[model samples]
Target: MSFPENKLTVRSSADLATAVPYLIGFHPADGSIVVIACRDRRIVFAARDDLPAPGTPAHHLRELTAHLIPVVQRQQPITDLMIVGYGTKEHIDPALRVIDDAFTATGLAVRELLRVTESRIFSLTCSNPACCPPQGTPVDPTTSLIAVHATVAGLVARPDRAAVASRFTSVDSTGDVIRHATTEATARKAALETAGSTAVFEAGVHAVRSALRQHDNDTPLTDDEVAWLTVLLTHRPVRDLAVDLTQPHDQHVTFWAEITRRADQALVPAPATVLALTAWRCGDGVLAVMAAERALQVDPNYPLAHLLLQALHAGLPPSAFEQATTSTHPNPSIPNPNTPSEQE
Candidate 1:
């Protein structure tokens, strides 16, 4: 989830319950398992997965643990872990027990285990009925402090994960106009190849930026403009240039997502991959996975799509990729202040 840098204090289970939705960028559906890792009282990362069925074997639970464990270990070290399952107590109890045992064997402290239904929260770790009522605490997630703060910060969580996935669906309008445009673009590609690679690459970048700017101001691209741009983008280097020119955050996402829908699917894995990256950066893992699926369906061997698929599978945060991109700068050597010869 894209959250404010300033930390919000979570002093109680109520507070944690309030924060989970914002942390994951959506309200988890029933049968969802959310795992939160924390260090020194601040949440480091949160991951949500679907809980296995009640009658599933032990290996299914182990596979779920395997998925969450790598994410916990990958980004940073944590001192405490919490698990929240969204379902009835009867259905989720077995999964929780398995999770508890897995974490125990891994030597990580399971600080809290909670079950959340539509109306109330049940805390399994807290024995005190006074602090946590035996019947469960009646709380509303929409009115939580974190939810209010998130609204003020302009971070809107989707209602559920499926809603997030719907954003990446391709426009499958196979009408006369779209077919004509695709044919025109294909013919244009042959001429674009003769236009010289450098010129084609530079034009592709300019067109992408212009399209994004127009998109921002609510100006739609003309059919010919879309045709030419789509044709030029088929070249790998030109596509890479367009990827580099995409603006930040949702704007980048919007640009590539529109392109992915409009462009011929068999010819443009670039826009799909860019859409996946932007979605991943925005913490919408559902869209990222769907966008990557679109790309892989177009070209199974596309490296960037495969990389993002692996990343989503491994539960790597977007910041890890950002850090990896910027970590290659050479450090300047510093003179020793304590050198006796230099002091003399």
Candidate 2:
């Protein structure tokens, strides 16, 4: 995901290290390699992946390099690249070499290479001991100027990927509630089928809007109400309608997150994909990846989830989706039911 046009001028290796977590939206773990793509020193996108295991064959590096080139190219022409390896000297060296060789082959400039440990950061490109000491320099993110600006902009740097994923976890008390909702939803589905697809779509649209309103008013849905809405949303027309109707933000994110956790995967792919799209639009790449994985698990051929996965992997900025949605469409206030449907 891309940050706002917030100015984060990186004057030193220490400044770069401090900005990595904010750029990627998480504090990376050990053995992770982070690639920050920039155009004229403004970050276009940042991605992180674990260092390939020791003894990984040459072909693996080639495959990774191939994947990265297109991802960077798709967003914008990468004028410069900063590669940061988060591990010990031995582990990071091979990975760095492989990445350097790959990018060089692609004719992309490698602006800098650095290594980050638990307590210090070392600049591989800078030989001047006065600036980048041979041993390393202690890096404190808290005291950095970028950290102060990020806080003012309401940006948060999560602890790790796992911490972000934990937001979608289901609660144990919902077991009986889910089972009851499923039964009710199934019965409603049978009745609606008899009324045909249009009726089903209409009912689903109404139910979805009502549910969102209830969620806004802090009114809890009954188990049966949740079940009916969940099942209705499985239909493609209904699901697409829901997507077209809602806007993305904090409360919408929370609503989809809870609904995704509550919905039975065996019953529908809508909740999972919706959750993925919402997370992606909100620039929570880690959570977006997890939700997309869950949606694919439920229905391997699900096109919406698959498309989102590709975009997420390609490091498409969240602003791309936001702009596309708003430039062509009007405000995201609730849709009028009397109007013609956007999806059949």
Candidate 3:
């Protein structure tokens, strides 16, 4: 969902419709409601949620509004917003009304309210039938200039959300390789345990630097290297070091995605969370959510993944995390793994 810092103007509703897929990195699911917040004519934040069911209560719609308003407020100074709902009138109308009212209460204008069916788009706010026909206006992204500009700007609109999630799915047929590497890595860790916590911690720091160099050179880590790194990342200090090293770049995404997919199942949370953080920093919220959800699937109590999910849900920008990280320094204490007090 990343775009250049330069502003891309939307002259008409049709152009906005065409640009949505590119902005979110995928076409939204049917029955979904998308909110795009703008500040002083620049697109700032975007979020999506499912429309309420047919029999849903009025309070349920209120709950939806409750969830969205805070997110919009967190991205404050939002001058206006656009809401697009993909579904039938029965489902979309009520939800749109609740959301629009809620946003307006917060003093932000609703620029456009649109309902998108399979073949056409209907403007709920526009009464004029000439430009926005009563029967709805046809929207063909293939013929859209906005689509052309988005493509030329190197933005990709995946066919659907699932297609974006598939990017982090496990690589095919590497289970046996990872298993054998895990066994060796476990033995090596046991030997290092006898040496002291400092030795294991230093080894992990070295491993992190070496892996970064390998990724920089466009050389994927071997099965053994992935195993050792994932095992060491279980150490909190080591994981923190890895997190500090991650940057907002596609290279970091590729590097961590491979590590996440190749790690043994029990060791997945660390690498997956790192991948989530990296994607968030890159402005790829869809990927960040997918990766964070994957980590929680492996370990529900993983605090870092939970924190990342919270930030994304609150609509906080990546700079929020960058500022926090830069302001705090790493703890200086390092306990020896051989000490009884340090053993978990």
Candidate 4:
């Protein structure tokens, strides 16, 4: 995630420690490693992954290095990086060395290497006790200016990654209501199909527009409305229209997230993938990855979800979708329902 340059800066280890959570949208777990890439002193990309087990085999470390190197490499022109490992030195050093060696071998400078714990942060490269104390420098993000700036800039540092993931979790209380609505929606959709592809496409487009308006108005969609929209989203053209209409805004995130949660099990992939795309565009990689994983869990062969996962893994910026977004027609082409299809 990129931050507003004027709002935040990292001048010291303490500041860097305070900024990590805001960069990734959550506090790193005890065994997590966060890598931030910078170009001309501005953070351009940041990602977090679990540290390999202490006794993990060399091949396993190699695999971990392989997975991470490409992600950083994809952010071309990165002059340096800050690598923070969250755990005790014993737990973090092994994987930290492997990663440091890998990046150094690739000719990229490691600007800082630090090990962080709940109470303090230790600079691995500095031995001068006067500055980098043996006991470590104390860290309290709650009192940090960086934290204040991040919050003022509308960035949220969730307690942990699980807290971020929980936003997309299904609501149990709505299950019975949605299930009943789905039954009625299914019957209605069958009747629309009988009227031919044109009718189905028009109805689906209308559903998409209406649902978006309701969300924009801060009006909750009725269970039947949510069910009908979810069913129509299963149509490829209708799903594409939803994608075209999604903007890189927090309300878009809120809208698609609610739809994904309320959608029937078989109908989740479309809305979930749209949620993923919306989150990514909003520069919330943590949320994007979670939403994409949720979709793939429901439909392993989902094409758009897989595409999103690939782009994310490759560290492509959200601007990569700029052309497609700008060129999108307000109205999507009508699909021939009779066309034999692969997975939608």
- Which clashing pairs does model 1 show? none
For model 1, residues 31-136, the per-residue Cα lDDT tens digits are 9999888776678778888988777787888998887887777756778889999998888867888888788788888999998877788898898999889899
Query: Residue-wise lDDT of candidate 2 within 1-344, one digit each (tens)?
Result: 22446666777788888888877778998889888888877777777887777678878767877787777777676688889999888888777888887887888888888999887998877899999898899999878887887777666678988766666656546777788779878888889899888778778877888888799999887767777888888777777667766667767777877787777657546887887888777766777888888788879998778877877887777677546545754444435645754543
Off by over 4 Å in 2: 1-3, 6-9, 217-222, 316-344
Structure candidate 4, residue pairs in collision: none
Give the TM-score (vs. native) of candidate 3. Answer: 0.89
Judging by TM-score, tell me the better candidate of 3 and 4: 4
Model 4 lDDT, residue 311, Cα: 82
- Which structure is stronger by TM-score: 1 or 3? 3
Off by over 4 Å in 1: 1-11, 171-176, 216-218, 317-344
- Location of the lowest summed lDDT over 10 successive residues in candidate 2: 328-337
- Candidate 2 pairs with clashing backbones: none
Clashes of 3: 0
lDDT of 3 by residue, 65-152 (tens): 8998898888887778899998887888777888898989988899889988886888999999987898888889999978888787
Best candidate according to TM-score: 4
Task: Estimate candidate 3's RMSD in Å.
Answer: 5.1
Listed per candidate, the RMSD to the true structure in angstroms reads: 8.7, 4.5, 5.1, 5.1
lDDT of each: 0.73, 0.77, 0.83, 0.84
Counted clashes in each candidate structure: 0, 0, 0, 0
Give the number of the best model, judged by lDDT: 4
